[model samples]
Target: MRRRIHAFSAVLALLFVAVFWISTVVSELFLSAAAVAQVKLAIAYALLGFVPVMMLTGASGFALGGKGRHPLLLAKRRRMSFIVANGLFVLAPAAVFLSIRAQAGSFDSVFYSVQALELAAGAANLGLIGLNIRDGIRLGRRRI
Candidate 1:
């Protein structure tokens, strides 16, 4: 049951990352006022949905690790830590800021620079989470 829960949570996290990336790309491509408002609404909804999914993913990961000292588990934990920190400290705030700036009709060079940084950070998070998922699978198979 724990294994199943962990697998489910990991898949959920992956799906969340994919959706976020898609939304980011779509938001970037459509910059009109109507499109911006719609994209902002989508982003807001995504953020609301992401919080609980991330919490479940982390909790299930911890439950699976359960004080074990396996190297793969440790690596997975570290990657998850990076994801959480980056999401909370960087991506979320940047998204909110960008949305506010868009609503305010401000799209200067600084906004683009910040958006680029946010995209990079988000991409990093996705990559790390993918690695973590691979590690988790290896740990499950006793191949780590």
Candidate 2:
């Protein structure tokens, strides 16, 4: 049951991050300023769901593997640590700031600068999450 919960939470969180990253990129590339603003606001609003999902993911993952010192679990936990930190410190703040800037029609250098940072950070999180998922699959396969 715990394993099921962890798997579901992890996948859900991954989907949330992927959608945020993809939407942001597509909006920036082809959409208008108003569209970008809408995307920004939408991402921010989505965080309401994303944040708790992440928390559940972490809690359930830790409950399942926190005591294990195996290399794969270690790797997953380390990646998760960075993932959580980046989500909290960098991504969330950038989303709010970008949302405000976009709403104000202030697509200045600072906004773009932060947007780039957000993209890079989001990409990093996506990769780390993918790696963790891969490691998790390996661990499960080993046990089976």
Which one wins on lDDT?
2
2-103 per-residue lDDT for model 1 (tens digits): 788878877887787777777767867865666765675567668888878888889988877889889888888788888999999988888788778777
Give the alpha carbon lDDT tens digit for every residue of 1-144 in model 2. 987887888899999989999999999999999999999999999999999999998998888775888899998999999999999999999999999999999999999999999999999999999898889888878762
Q: Estimate each model's TM-score.
A: 0.88, 0.96
Predicted structure 1: clash tally: 0
Among all candidates shown, the one with the greatest TM-score: 2
Worst 10 residues of 2 by lDDT: 135-144
lDDT for position 144 in model 2: 23
Residue 46, candidate 1: Cα error in Å is 1.6
Q: Cα RMSD to native, each candidate?
A: 2.0, 1.1
Off by over 4 Å in 2: none
| Location of the lowest summed lDDT over 10 successive residues in candidate 1 | 31-40
